[model samples]
Target: MRDFFEVRDVHVMRSGAHGPLPVLGGVDLRVGRGELVCVVGPSGCGKSTLLGVVAGLLRPARGRVLLAGRDVTGTPAHTAYMPQQDLLFAWHTVLDGVALGLRVQRVGRREARARARDVLAEFGLEAFADARPDELSGGMRQRAALARTVLQGRDVVLLDEPFGALDALTRLDAQRWLAATWRAHRWTGLLVTHDVGEAVTLGDRVLRLSGRPAVVAQEVAVDEPRPRTPGVPDERVVRTVLAGLGVVPDERAPDEREPDERAPGLPVRLP
Candidate 1:
């Protein structure tokens, strides 16, 4: 089957204080229709920058972005992006916040709000529909933001550390919630996260990126079926991914050390 979304030989450079700095160097990726792919990399390894390029928020110096066989380079209309923070409008009610996308599409206020309410109900946020951003918990806020993203009905969703800010328990809840939601709608998703366990649990495949001008170092297929529980990914898969990223000692190492005892959410140093 033809790929649903693709980033072909993408190269992105940014102007730093001193000079030009390369963020992505000849990066290539593809996500099939109804597939969920998670990208895990060291902190400041240009994961978010890569997502921005794909979302058309930033243009790559070279290479093309294709969505469902159509080239959409530098076109933000083709995808919906949800950043690390929920960025909810503090003044607007939860319902209105979720309805923002539809309203932007020239949907009537009444109709947009009705659609938002239905989706919010599906997300189990109906009771908080009238609540303001401040009134909802951190998890609820993220859920509301996701509702807005889904309401846009875009073919691809770019999530940049969407659950990074939540507490352990809350993040787990959000992960499971997102996985179930994705299974229901099956919109192609590319999520950039630092949590290895999260990637293993939520993604159909996890891509590990490393180095200064990062490229895909390895792609580990989850193989497990979804509706997966958060924080409970297959230990073997997690170990394989960590080893590929050099987060854990490689089995081939002559003097292999015990697996790192650090918690799952801690940042993995780039080699």
Candidate 2:
């Protein structure tokens, strides 16, 4: 695959309770043009940190970020990044919030809101265009945030648990919507998700990272078609990701296997 967006040997260190803490250790990632790739790893791993570096929000200690083969380290304008939170300003109207990116691009506020209102309709938020974020539902807020990111017209998009804050049902709904939206936009995406199913459903490939200053441990190709329904992750691909994260279900019958093995949401460890 052509490396449209690449992170090479990235190393990140953040101030922690105990001096500088290593977050990413020699992480390398490559995504083809317009490919949606999912990244999964142990909790507290450098997943979010990796996205920060790739988005140019945080400069890596030792590595380079490339977009279409152009080095763009410490340049935040190259990509549109939607972090874990919806992060909609409560004071700004839905239209204004969605228009923030365009305004940042030097588009006049009047023209930006005009464009934002049009996009809000696409997200089914036209009726609430004048409403504040507090007046909108969680799903609606997320949609507005996404519309804003997409309006930036960046070729690369980074999503950090975009649906993690939503409830299960809402998350499922958001996932479905995002999949369809992504299919339509076809922007190159790098999403950090803990749900193996979400990764399989949305990603063309899944990368598993090991913890303690994370590093890529395995890469699992997802051969499924796009616009896949959310909540129904492919067993084949999910198992591959989980197994890569060192999670294995006991084949023995329930009577013989350990209870934890039979339980749902088994804790997967990274070695």
Every candidate's lDDT: 0.87, 0.84
Q: Could you tell me every candidate's TM-score relative to the true structure?
A: 0.91, 0.89
RMSD (CA, Å), each prediction: 5.4, 5.8
For candidate 1, report its TM-score: 0.91
Model 1 lDDT-worst window of ten = 261-270
Give one digit per residue, the lDDT tens place, for model 1 in 1-271.
Answer: 3578898888888899999999888788889998889999888889999999999999899999998888999999988899999999999999999999989889999999999999999999999999999999999999999999989998899899999999999999998789878988998899999999999999988888866588776777798876687888988889977886777865645444323313322323212
Say what the RMSD of model 2 is.
Answer: 5.8
Model 1's number of clashes is 0
Q: Please report how far candidate 1 places residue 144 from its true position, in Å.
A: 0.5
For model 2, the superposed segments whose C-alpha errors exceed 4 Å read: 16-19, 250-271
lDDT tens per residue, model 2, 216-254: 777777887765878888887786567556687534467
